[model samples]
Target: MTTLPSSTRRKLGLVIDLDTCVGCHACVVSCKGWNTENYGAPLSDQDPYGAEPSGTFLNRVHSYEVQPDDGTAQLVHFPKSCLHCDNAPCVTVCPTGASYKRQEDGIVLVNEDTCIGCGLCAWACPYGAREMDAAAKVMKKCTLCVDRIYNENLPEVDRVPACVRTCPSNARHFGDLADPDSDVSQLVAARGGMDLMPEQGTAPVNKYLPPRLKDRLDRTEEIDVLAPFLAPVTDQPKGFLGWLDKALDKI
Candidate 1:
Protein backbone atom coordinates (compact mmCIF):
# COMPACT_ATOMS: atom_id res chain seq x y z
CA MET A 1 0.00 0.00 0.00
CA THR A 2 1.15 3.51 -0.77
CA THR A 3 1.45 6.10 1.96
CA LEU A 4 0.02 9.58 1.58
CA PRO A 5 2.23 12.65 1.62
CA SER A 6 2.96 13.96 5.14
CA SER A 7 1.61 17.30 4.03
CA THR A 8 0.69 19.00 0.80
CA ARG A 9 1.92 22.46 -0.09
CA ARG A 10 -1.51 23.60 -1.28
CA LYS A 11 -4.93 22.00 -1.31
CA LEU A 12 -6.16 22.91 -4.76
CA GLY A 13 -9.80 21.93 -5.09
CA LEU A 14 -13.34 22.91 -6.13
CA VAL A 15 -16.07 24.90 -4.36
CA ILE A 16 -19.50 23.97 -5.73
CA ASP A 17 -22.46 26.23 -4.86
CA LEU A 18 -25.62 24.20 -4.62
CA ASP A 19 -27.68 27.40 -4.28
CA THR A 20 -26.84 28.74 -7.73
CA CYS A 21 -26.57 25.46 -9.70
CA VAL A 22 -29.43 24.96 -12.19
CA GLY A 23 -28.89 21.23 -12.95
CA CYS A 24 -27.91 22.11 -16.52
CA HIS A 25 -25.21 19.34 -16.77
CA ALA A 26 -23.08 21.80 -18.73
CA CYS A 27 -20.18 21.15 -16.37
CA VAL A 28 -20.53 17.39 -16.85
CA VAL A 29 -20.33 17.66 -20.63
CA SER A 30 -17.45 20.12 -20.52
CA CYS A 31 -15.47 17.87 -18.16
CA LYS A 32 -15.95 14.87 -20.43
CA GLY A 33 -14.88 16.80 -23.53
CA TRP A 34 -11.76 18.36 -21.99
CA ASN A 35 -10.58 15.26 -20.14
CA THR A 36 -11.07 12.87 -23.06
CA GLU A 37 -8.28 14.67 -24.89
CA ASN A 38 -6.09 16.08 -22.14
CA TYR A 39 -5.50 13.97 -19.05
CA GLY A 40 -4.86 10.57 -17.45
CA ALA A 41 -6.72 8.46 -19.99
CA PRO A 42 -9.45 8.75 -22.62
CA LEU A 43 -12.89 8.58 -21.01
CA SER A 44 -14.29 5.52 -22.76
CA ASP A 45 -17.79 4.82 -24.03
CA GLN A 46 -19.17 1.36 -24.74
CA ASP A 47 -22.06 0.47 -27.05
CA PRO A 48 -22.70 4.00 -28.26
CA TYR A 49 -25.19 2.87 -30.94
CA GLY A 50 -26.44 -0.22 -29.12
CA ALA A 51 -29.38 -0.63 -26.75
CA GLU A 52 -27.28 -0.56 -23.56
CA PRO A 53 -24.78 2.27 -23.41
CA SER A 54 -22.29 3.05 -20.66
CA GLY A 55 -19.63 5.72 -20.57
CA THR A 56 -16.99 7.05 -18.19
CA PHE A 57 -17.15 10.63 -16.96
CA LEU A 58 -15.01 12.45 -14.42
CA ASN A 59 -17.85 14.70 -13.21
CA ARG A 60 -21.55 14.02 -12.75
CA VAL A 61 -24.58 15.95 -11.49
CA HIS A 62 -27.44 14.44 -9.51
CA SER A 63 -30.75 16.03 -8.53
CA TYR A 64 -32.70 15.40 -5.34
CA GLU A 65 -36.00 16.79 -4.05
CA VAL A 66 -36.08 17.66 -0.37
CA GLN A 67 -39.10 18.87 1.61
CA PRO A 68 -38.54 21.15 4.56
CA ASP A 69 -40.48 21.07 7.84
CA ASP A 70 -42.83 23.75 6.48
CA GLY A 71 -43.73 21.35 3.59
CA THR A 72 -41.93 23.38 0.94
CA ALA A 73 -40.12 21.06 -1.44
CA GLN A 74 -36.93 22.14 -3.18
CA LEU A 75 -35.06 20.43 -5.99
CA VAL A 76 -31.33 20.53 -5.41
CA HIS A 77 -28.73 19.93 -8.11
CA PHE A 78 -25.58 18.24 -6.78
CA PRO A 79 -22.38 18.08 -8.77
CA LYS A 80 -19.90 15.42 -7.60
CA SER A 81 -16.37 14.35 -8.38
CA CYS A 82 -13.19 13.41 -6.59
CA LEU A 83 -12.95 15.42 -3.35
CA HIS A 84 -9.12 14.88 -3.20
CA CYS A 85 -9.11 14.03 0.47
CA ASP A 86 -6.08 14.84 2.59
CA ASN A 87 -6.02 11.28 3.91
CA ALA A 88 -7.28 9.51 0.79
CA PRO A 89 -8.01 5.90 1.54
CA CYS A 90 -7.88 5.10 -2.17
CA VAL A 91 -4.21 6.05 -2.26
CA THR A 92 -3.32 4.09 0.85
CA VAL A 93 -5.04 0.97 -0.52
CA CYS A 94 -3.27 0.98 -3.84
CA PRO A 95 -0.85 -2.00 -3.82
CA THR A 96 1.16 -0.35 -6.54
CA GLY A 97 2.56 3.17 -6.48
CA ALA A 98 0.18 4.15 -9.32
CA SER A 99 -2.26 5.89 -7.01
CA TYR A 100 -0.48 8.85 -5.44
CA LYS A 101 -1.19 12.38 -4.26
CA ARG A 102 1.00 15.21 -5.50
CA GLN A 103 2.92 16.86 -2.68
CA GLU A 104 3.10 20.16 -4.56
CA ASP A 105 -0.64 20.78 -5.17
CA GLY A 106 -2.36 17.78 -3.50
CA ILE A 107 -4.01 16.46 -6.65
CA VAL A 108 -4.65 12.71 -6.46
CA LEU A 109 -3.81 10.92 -9.71
CA VAL A 110 -3.22 7.43 -11.04
CA ASN A 111 -0.24 6.53 -13.12
CA GLU A 112 -1.92 4.45 -15.82
CA ASP A 113 1.36 2.78 -16.72
CA THR A 114 1.86 1.47 -13.18
CA CYS A 115 -1.77 0.65 -12.43
CA ILE A 116 -2.72 -3.03 -12.63
CA GLY A 117 -6.50 -2.43 -12.87
CA CYS A 118 -7.06 -4.36 -9.62
CA GLY A 119 -9.99 -2.12 -8.58
CA LEU A 120 -8.62 -1.75 -5.03
CA CYS A 121 -8.63 2.02 -5.34
CA ALA A 122 -12.27 2.01 -6.40
CA TRP A 123 -13.24 -0.20 -3.47
CA ALA A 124 -11.33 2.00 -1.04
CA CYS A 125 -12.86 5.29 -2.17
CA PRO A 126 -15.98 6.08 -0.12
CA TYR A 127 -17.23 8.71 -2.58
CA GLY A 128 -17.37 6.27 -5.57
CA ALA A 129 -15.20 8.76 -7.45
CA ARG A 130 -12.99 6.09 -8.99
CA GLU A 131 -14.06 4.48 -12.27
CA MET A 132 -12.59 1.53 -14.13
CA ASP A 133 -11.70 2.43 -17.70
CA ALA A 134 -12.77 -0.62 -19.68
CA ALA A 135 -10.49 0.29 -22.58
CA ALA A 136 -7.29 0.89 -20.61
CA LYS A 137 -8.28 -1.45 -17.78
CA VAL A 138 -7.09 1.20 -15.31
CA MET A 139 -8.85 3.20 -12.62
CA LYS A 140 -9.49 6.89 -13.28
CA LYS A 141 -10.87 9.86 -11.41
CA CYS A 142 -10.89 13.65 -11.50
CA THR A 143 -7.41 15.22 -11.42
CA LEU A 144 -8.75 18.74 -10.92
CA CYS A 145 -7.65 19.41 -14.47
CA VAL A 146 -4.01 19.25 -13.36
CA ASP A 147 -2.71 19.20 -16.93
CA ARG A 148 -4.71 22.23 -18.06
CA ILE A 149 -4.38 24.27 -14.89
CA TYR A 150 -0.58 24.03 -14.93
CA ASN A 151 -0.04 24.10 -18.69
CA GLU A 152 2.12 27.07 -19.60
CA ASN A 153 0.83 27.02 -23.17
CA LEU A 154 -2.64 28.12 -22.10
CA PRO A 155 -3.48 31.73 -21.30
CA GLU A 156 -3.14 32.74 -17.64
CA VAL A 157 -6.85 33.47 -17.32
CA ASP A 158 -7.81 30.09 -18.84
CA ARG A 159 -5.91 28.06 -16.23
CA VAL A 160 -8.79 26.45 -14.34
CA PRO A 161 -10.73 23.20 -14.29
CA ALA A 162 -12.82 22.59 -17.42
CA CYS A 163 -16.03 22.26 -15.38
CA VAL A 164 -15.38 25.62 -13.67
CA ARG A 165 -14.74 27.30 -17.02
CA THR A 166 -17.87 25.86 -18.66
CA CYS A 167 -20.40 26.22 -15.85
CA PRO A 168 -23.24 28.46 -17.09
CA SER A 169 -24.51 29.18 -13.58
CA ASN A 170 -21.15 30.25 -12.12
CA ALA A 171 -21.71 27.63 -9.45
CA ARG A 172 -18.29 25.96 -9.66
CA HIS A 173 -15.12 27.63 -8.39
CA PHE A 174 -11.44 26.59 -8.23
CA GLY A 175 -8.50 27.86 -6.18
CA ASP A 176 -6.00 26.96 -3.49
CA LEU A 177 -8.15 26.06 -0.51
CA ALA A 178 -5.13 25.98 1.82
CA ASP A 179 -4.76 29.76 1.51
CA PRO A 180 -7.12 31.45 3.97
CA ASP A 181 -7.19 34.62 1.86
CA SER A 182 -7.95 32.81 -1.42
CA ASP A 183 -11.21 33.65 -3.15
CA VAL A 184 -12.48 30.10 -2.77
CA SER A 185 -11.67 30.11 0.96
CA GLN A 186 -13.36 33.50 1.44
CA LEU A 187 -16.40 32.26 -0.47
CA VAL A 188 -16.54 29.14 1.66
CA ALA A 189 -16.33 31.22 4.83
CA ALA A 190 -19.03 33.62 3.65
CA ARG A 191 -21.41 30.92 2.42
CA GLY A 192 -20.92 28.34 5.21
CA GLY A 193 -19.47 25.69 2.93
CA MET A 194 -19.44 22.07 4.12
CA ASP A 195 -17.74 18.79 3.35
CA LEU A 196 -19.74 15.99 1.75
CA MET A 197 -19.19 13.24 4.35
CA PRO A 198 -17.12 14.43 7.27
CA GLU A 199 -17.64 11.22 9.26
CA GLN A 200 -15.37 9.31 6.88
CA GLY A 201 -12.36 11.26 8.23
CA THR A 202 -10.97 11.86 4.75
CA ALA A 203 -10.68 15.61 5.25
CA PRO A 204 -11.77 16.37 1.70
CA VAL A 205 -10.37 19.51 0.14
CA ASN A 206 -13.52 20.33 -1.83
CA LYS A 207 -16.43 22.17 -0.22
CA TYR A 208 -20.09 22.66 -1.08
CA LEU A 209 -21.98 25.88 -0.48
CA PRO A 210 -25.39 24.92 0.81
CA PRO A 211 -28.54 26.35 -0.74
CA ARG A 212 -29.75 29.56 0.88
CA LEU A 213 -33.03 29.49 2.82
CA LYS A 214 -33.98 33.11 2.18
CA ASP A 215 -36.00 32.15 -0.89
CA ARG A 216 -38.09 29.81 1.22
CA LEU A 217 -38.76 32.39 3.92
CA ASP A 218 -42.17 34.05 3.82
CA ARG A 219 -41.10 37.06 5.83
CA THR A 220 -40.61 40.22 3.75
CA GLU A 221 -37.90 41.49 6.09
CA GLU A 222 -35.80 38.32 5.62
CA ILE A 223 -36.12 38.52 1.85
CA ASP A 224 -35.23 42.18 1.81
CA VAL A 225 -32.01 41.61 3.70
CA LEU A 226 -30.89 38.84 1.31
CA ALA A 227 -32.06 40.54 -1.89
CA PRO A 228 -29.09 42.87 -1.94
CA PHE A 229 -26.68 39.94 -1.89
CA LEU A 230 -28.47 37.74 -4.40
CA ALA A 231 -28.10 38.66 -8.07
CA PRO A 232 -31.12 38.26 -10.30
CA VAL A 233 -30.82 35.06 -12.36
CA THR A 234 -32.09 36.89 -15.43
CA ASP A 235 -29.29 39.42 -15.13
CA GLN A 236 -26.54 36.75 -15.31
CA PRO A 237 -24.35 36.80 -18.43
CA LYS A 238 -25.73 34.60 -21.22
CA GLY A 239 -22.56 33.84 -23.15
CA PHE A 240 -21.02 30.70 -21.68
CA LEU A 241 -17.27 31.44 -21.63
CA GLY A 242 -17.88 35.16 -21.28
CA TRP A 243 -19.72 34.65 -18.00
CA LEU A 244 -16.91 32.39 -16.78
CA ASP A 245 -14.29 35.06 -17.42
CA LYS A 246 -16.33 37.63 -15.51
CA ALA A 247 -16.72 35.30 -12.54
CA LEU A 248 -13.03 34.35 -12.57
CA ASP A 249 -12.09 38.00 -12.48
CA LYS A 250 -13.98 38.37 -9.20
CA ILE A 251 -12.06 35.40 -7.78
Candidate 2:
Protein backbone atom coordinates (compact mmCIF):
# COMPACT_ATOMS: atom_id res chain seq x y z
CA MET A 1 0.00 0.00 0.00
CA THR A 2 1.14 3.56 -0.72
CA THR A 3 1.32 6.44 1.71
CA LEU A 4 0.79 10.17 1.19
CA PRO A 5 3.10 12.97 2.25
CA SER A 6 2.53 14.38 5.76
CA SER A 7 1.75 17.72 4.17
CA THR A 8 2.24 19.45 0.86
CA ARG A 9 3.98 22.79 0.32
CA ARG A 10 1.33 24.06 -2.10
CA LYS A 11 -2.04 22.52 -2.65
CA LEU A 12 -2.77 23.20 -6.29
CA GLY A 13 -6.32 22.48 -7.46
CA LEU A 14 -9.31 23.64 -9.46
CA VAL A 15 -12.22 25.87 -8.47
CA ILE A 16 -15.33 25.28 -10.59
CA ASP A 17 -18.31 27.62 -10.79
CA LEU A 18 -21.65 25.85 -11.13
CA ASP A 19 -23.40 29.13 -11.90
CA THR A 20 -21.36 30.15 -14.96
CA CYS A 21 -20.90 26.73 -16.53
CA VAL A 22 -23.05 26.37 -19.66
CA GLY A 23 -22.79 22.57 -20.02
CA CYS A 24 -20.99 23.14 -23.33
CA HIS A 25 -18.78 20.01 -23.06
CA ALA A 26 -15.92 22.15 -24.40
CA CYS A 27 -13.86 21.29 -21.33
CA VAL A 28 -14.48 17.59 -21.90
CA VAL A 29 -13.48 17.72 -25.56
CA SER A 30 -10.44 19.93 -24.95
CA CYS A 31 -9.26 17.76 -22.06
CA LYS A 32 -9.57 14.65 -24.19
CA GLY A 33 -7.64 16.24 -27.02
CA TRP A 34 -4.73 17.56 -24.90
CA ASN A 35 -4.24 14.76 -22.37
CA THR A 36 -4.38 11.98 -24.98
CA GLU A 37 -1.13 13.25 -26.45
CA ASN A 38 0.80 15.09 -23.74
CA TYR A 39 0.18 13.28 -20.49
CA GLY A 40 1.21 9.87 -19.11
CA ALA A 41 -0.86 7.74 -21.52
CA PRO A 42 -3.12 8.13 -24.48
CA LEU A 43 -6.88 8.20 -23.78
CA SER A 44 -8.47 5.59 -26.02
CA ASP A 45 -11.88 5.39 -27.63
CA GLN A 46 -13.35 1.91 -28.15
CA ASP A 47 -15.50 1.30 -31.25
CA PRO A 48 -16.03 5.00 -31.85
CA TYR A 49 -19.01 5.81 -34.11
CA GLY A 50 -20.33 2.31 -33.43
CA ALA A 51 -23.40 1.06 -31.63
CA GLU A 52 -21.71 1.37 -28.26
CA PRO A 53 -19.14 4.12 -28.06
CA SER A 54 -17.05 4.85 -25.02
CA GLY A 55 -13.72 6.47 -24.28
CA THR A 56 -11.47 7.62 -21.44
CA PHE A 57 -11.84 11.23 -20.32
CA LEU A 58 -10.31 13.28 -17.51
CA ASN A 59 -13.15 15.80 -17.08
CA ARG A 60 -16.90 15.43 -17.56
CA VAL A 61 -19.87 17.82 -17.21
CA HIS A 62 -23.09 16.62 -15.64
CA SER A 63 -26.34 18.58 -15.77
CA TYR A 64 -29.13 18.44 -13.18
CA GLU A 65 -32.50 20.17 -12.86
CA VAL A 66 -32.62 21.54 -9.32
CA GLN A 67 -35.80 23.15 -7.92
CA PRO A 68 -35.01 25.65 -5.20
CA ASP A 69 -37.35 26.60 -2.33
CA ASP A 70 -38.41 29.67 -4.31
CA GLY A 71 -40.21 27.42 -6.84
CA THR A 72 -37.91 28.16 -9.78
CA ALA A 73 -36.18 25.19 -11.35
CA GLN A 74 -32.57 25.72 -12.47
CA LEU A 75 -30.31 23.60 -14.61
CA VAL A 76 -26.97 23.19 -12.85
CA HIS A 77 -23.92 22.22 -14.92
CA PHE A 78 -21.38 20.40 -12.77
CA PRO A 79 -17.88 19.70 -14.06
CA LYS A 80 -16.03 16.97 -12.16
CA SER A 81 -12.44 15.74 -12.02
CA CYS A 82 -9.88 14.46 -9.55
CA LEU A 83 -9.94 16.62 -6.37
CA HIS A 84 -6.29 15.76 -5.40
CA CYS A 85 -7.19 15.20 -1.78
CA ASP A 86 -4.69 15.84 0.98
CA ASN A 87 -5.38 12.38 2.42
CA ALA A 88 -6.16 10.57 -0.83
CA PRO A 89 -7.52 7.08 -0.28
CA CYS A 90 -6.66 6.19 -3.86
CA VAL A 91 -2.96 6.47 -2.98
CA THR A 92 -3.28 4.39 0.18
CA VAL A 93 -5.03 1.50 -1.61
CA CYS A 94 -2.62 1.25 -4.55
CA PRO A 95 -0.74 -1.99 -4.20
CA THR A 96 2.13 -1.13 -6.56
CA GLY A 97 2.82 2.43 -5.34
CA ALA A 98 1.78 3.68 -8.75
CA SER A 99 -0.61 6.26 -7.36
CA TYR A 100 1.17 8.99 -5.40
CA LYS A 101 0.78 12.66 -4.52
CA ARG A 102 3.39 15.31 -5.26
CA GLN A 103 4.58 17.18 -2.21
CA GLU A 104 5.59 20.25 -4.23
CA ASP A 105 2.35 21.07 -6.06
CA GLY A 106 0.08 18.42 -4.48
CA ILE A 107 -1.00 16.88 -7.77
CA VAL A 108 -1.88 13.18 -7.59
CA LEU A 109 -0.46 11.14 -10.47
CA VAL A 110 -0.05 7.52 -11.43
CA ASN A 111 3.19 5.88 -12.50
CA GLU A 112 1.96 4.16 -15.63
CA ASP A 113 5.09 2.02 -15.88
CA THR A 114 4.51 0.60 -12.40
CA CYS A 115 0.71 0.27 -12.70
CA ILE A 116 -0.52 -3.32 -13.26
CA GLY A 117 -4.16 -2.35 -13.88
CA CYS A 118 -5.29 -4.00 -10.60
CA GLY A 119 -8.10 -1.37 -10.46
CA LEU A 120 -7.71 -0.86 -6.72
CA CYS A 121 -7.09 2.86 -7.07
CA ALA A 122 -10.26 3.28 -9.13
CA TRP A 123 -12.23 1.25 -6.60
CA ALA A 124 -10.91 3.35 -3.73
CA CYS A 125 -11.68 6.70 -5.32
CA PRO A 126 -15.06 7.92 -4.00
CA TYR A 127 -15.42 10.56 -6.70
CA GLY A 128 -15.27 8.08 -9.63
CA ALA A 129 -12.44 10.14 -11.10
CA ARG A 130 -10.25 7.23 -12.19
CA GLU A 131 -10.77 5.21 -15.37
CA MET A 132 -9.17 2.09 -16.79
CA ASP A 133 -7.85 2.35 -20.32
CA ALA A 134 -8.91 -0.92 -21.94
CA ALA A 135 -6.33 -0.64 -24.71
CA ALA A 136 -3.26 0.13 -22.57
CA LYS A 137 -4.53 -1.70 -19.49
CA VAL A 138 -3.44 1.17 -17.20
CA MET A 139 -5.39 3.37 -14.81
CA LYS A 140 -5.72 7.05 -15.84
CA LYS A 141 -6.98 10.24 -14.25
CA CYS A 142 -6.53 13.98 -14.43
CA THR A 143 -2.95 15.21 -13.89
CA LEU A 144 -4.14 18.83 -14.10
CA CYS A 145 -2.24 19.04 -17.37
CA VAL A 146 1.08 18.57 -15.62
CA ASP A 147 2.98 18.56 -18.89
CA ARG A 148 1.46 21.82 -20.15
CA ILE A 149 1.40 23.78 -16.92
CA TYR A 150 5.12 23.23 -16.28
CA ASN A 151 6.44 23.45 -19.80
CA GLU A 152 8.69 26.49 -20.22
CA ASN A 153 8.40 26.34 -23.99
CA LEU A 154 4.71 27.23 -23.78
CA PRO A 155 3.58 30.81 -23.19
CA GLU A 156 2.90 31.78 -19.58
CA VAL A 157 -0.74 32.58 -20.37
CA ASP A 158 -1.24 29.11 -21.90
CA ARG A 159 0.20 27.22 -18.93
CA VAL A 160 -3.12 26.40 -17.27
CA PRO A 161 -4.98 23.08 -17.58
CA ALA A 162 -6.47 22.47 -21.03
CA CYS A 163 -10.00 22.53 -19.62
CA VAL A 164 -9.37 25.91 -17.99
CA ARG A 165 -7.91 27.36 -21.18
CA THR A 166 -10.80 26.19 -23.37
CA CYS A 167 -13.75 26.98 -21.14
CA PRO A 168 -15.87 29.47 -23.10
CA SER A 169 -17.68 30.69 -20.00
CA ASN A 170 -14.48 30.98 -17.86
CA ALA A 171 -16.06 28.77 -15.21
CA ARG A 172 -12.85 26.86 -14.38
CA HIS A 173 -9.94 28.34 -12.37
CA PHE A 174 -6.61 26.85 -11.29
CA GLY A 175 -4.17 28.02 -8.63
CA ASP A 176 -2.52 27.08 -5.38
CA LEU A 177 -5.25 26.59 -2.80
CA ALA A 178 -2.67 26.67 -0.02
CA ASP A 179 -1.99 30.32 -0.70
CA PRO A 180 -4.85 32.36 0.73
CA ASP A 181 -3.82 35.34 -1.41
CA SER A 182 -3.97 33.43 -4.70
CA ASP A 183 -6.67 34.36 -7.17
CA VAL A 184 -8.34 30.96 -6.96
CA SER A 185 -8.38 31.08 -3.16
CA GLN A 186 -9.75 34.61 -3.15
CA LEU A 187 -12.50 33.57 -5.60
CA VAL A 188 -13.42 30.63 -3.39
CA ALA A 189 -13.61 32.90 -0.35
CA ALA A 190 -15.70 35.50 -2.15
CA ARG A 191 -18.16 32.95 -3.58
CA GLY A 192 -18.48 30.77 -0.46
CA GLY A 193 -17.08 27.76 -2.30
CA MET A 194 -17.53 24.30 -0.80
CA ASP A 195 -15.99 20.89 -1.15
CA LEU A 196 -18.03 18.02 -2.54
CA MET A 197 -19.16 15.36 -0.02
CA PRO A 198 -17.13 16.72 2.87
CA GLU A 199 -18.46 13.88 5.04
CA GLN A 200 -16.38 11.41 3.00
CA GLY A 201 -13.20 12.88 4.56
CA THR A 202 -11.10 12.82 1.40
CA ALA A 203 -10.03 16.40 2.15
CA PRO A 204 -10.34 17.24 -1.53
CA VAL A 205 -8.45 20.33 -2.54
CA ASN A 206 -10.86 21.39 -5.29
CA LYS A 207 -13.79 23.62 -4.39
CA TYR A 208 -17.11 24.27 -6.14
CA LEU A 209 -18.96 27.58 -6.22
CA PRO A 210 -22.64 27.06 -5.56
CA PRO A 211 -25.31 28.23 -7.96
CA ARG A 212 -26.33 31.81 -7.26
CA LEU A 213 -29.93 32.34 -6.19
CA LYS A 214 -32.02 33.94 -8.89
CA ASP A 215 -34.13 36.98 -8.00
CA ARG A 216 -37.78 36.01 -7.98
CA LEU A 217 -40.06 38.36 -9.89
CA ASP A 218 -43.07 39.71 -7.97
CA ARG A 219 -46.25 38.11 -9.33
CA THR A 220 -48.86 39.87 -7.12
CA GLU A 221 -49.57 42.69 -9.62
CA GLU A 222 -51.88 41.87 -12.54
CA ILE A 223 -50.41 42.34 -16.03
CA ASP A 224 -52.17 44.52 -18.58
CA VAL A 225 -53.18 42.62 -21.72
CA LEU A 226 -52.30 44.15 -25.09
CA ALA A 227 -55.03 44.62 -27.73
CA PRO A 228 -55.22 41.85 -30.30
CA PHE A 229 -55.27 44.28 -33.25
CA LEU A 230 -53.60 47.63 -33.82
CA ALA A 231 -55.73 50.77 -34.39
CA PRO A 232 -55.95 51.80 -38.06
CA VAL A 233 -53.91 54.93 -39.02
CA THR A 234 -56.00 57.87 -40.33
CA ASP A 235 -53.40 58.82 -42.99
CA GLN A 236 -49.82 57.84 -43.76
CA PRO A 237 -47.34 60.65 -42.86
CA LYS A 238 -44.46 61.64 -45.16
CA GLY A 239 -40.62 61.34 -44.78
CA PHE A 240 -39.91 58.94 -41.82
CA LEU A 241 -43.44 57.53 -42.06
CA GLY A 242 -42.85 56.79 -45.79
CA TRP A 243 -39.74 54.72 -44.89
CA LEU A 244 -41.76 52.94 -42.13
CA ASP A 245 -44.54 52.28 -44.70
CA LYS A 246 -42.01 50.79 -47.14
CA ALA A 247 -40.55 48.53 -44.38
CA LEU A 248 -44.08 47.44 -43.33
CA ASP A 249 -44.93 46.68 -46.98
CA LYS A 250 -41.93 44.33 -47.22
CA ILE A 251 -43.02 42.65 -43.98
Q: Give the TM-scores of the predictions, in the order they appear.
A: 0.86, 0.86
**Model 1 regions more than 4 Å off:** 217-251
Error of 2 at 233 (Å): 28
Residue 206 of model 2: what lDDT? 96
Q: 59-86 in candidate 1: lDDT tens per residue? A: 8999999888874699999999999999
RMSD of 2: 8.5
- Stretches off by above 4 angstroms in model 2 are 218-251
TM-score for candidate 1: 0.86
Over 1-251, each residue of candidate 2 has an lDDT whose tens digit, in order, gives 27899999999999999999999999999999999998787999999999999999888889999987766688999999999999899999998989999989999999999999999989988999999998999999999999989999999999999999999999999999999999999999999999998988999999999988665555422332342344445567679988999899999
After TM-score superposition, the amount by which residue 7's alpha carbon in candidate 2 deviates from its true location, in angstroms, is 0.5
RMSD values, in order shown: 14.6, 8.5
Candidate topping TM-score? 2
